[model samples]
Target: MEYQYKEVRRELAARADTVIWLDHPFATVMTRLVRRTVRRRAGRVELWNGNQESSLWSVFTDPEHILRWGWKSYGRNRARVRALVGQVVVVRLSGQGQVERWLTGPLAAVGEERAR
Candidate 1:
């Protein structure tokens, strides 16, 4: 997770950065299904930190797949985070002046994120 975050940070700072970490290959349900099918049908192999891609059977046969987690978390967390952020003064910052104020003013001292 930290490596992914660091890659994102670096990508933002660099011009035309080819960041593999930022690329979530299984971003869509359809893509994941396709990938799983191809892997199982063709015996296409994949390894993650020395683990094989669950023979592609997990895309359906396994309930604990990442896709399941995504489905469950997306509904719950989006609303939860929205409400949680409402407790803070979420500055939907759009310009440099706001960023400047955030650094030099009380926005930084709020103990949490805040608006101008």
Candidate 2:
């Protein structure tokens, strides 16, 4: 599940057997955030509660803009997820390569096991 607060994640993790953490780099995260925001804004897509993305310029003027918020929270989020390593089973995928491998390897194995 997507959660912004550490307390919320911690609570959720307590009941979860495995937590998949996409520990991507800052550059990758920002790039994807910008791309998604631009696509949503350009397409006038409706987000949760009828909220649509604001002007891209809002990245500079709006402190609470999604892009800005993502940039500010990236490091803190990583640290929080890292702290969960020993508390629960966390499959931290750092790069796209690792993610691809995990999907085809370990995750696929689990799927096979469940199908048995």
Best-matching candidate per lDDT:
2
lDDT of 2: 0.87
Weakest lDDT window of 10 consecutive positions for candidate 1 = 16-25
lDDT of 1 by residue, 3-71 (tens): 223346444434322221212223454466556656645764544565554545575777766556555
Clashes of 1: 0
Q: What does candidate 2's lDDT look like per residue over 1-116, in tens digits?
A: 87567557767877877779998889999999999989999999999899999999988899999998998999888887787788878888999999999889856988989999
| lDDT for residue 97 in candidate 2, whole number 0-100 | 92
Highest TM-score against the true fold, candidate: 2
Query: Per-candidate TM vs. native?
Result: 0.35, 0.86
**What stretches of model 1 exceed 4 Å from their correct place?**
1-48, 91-116
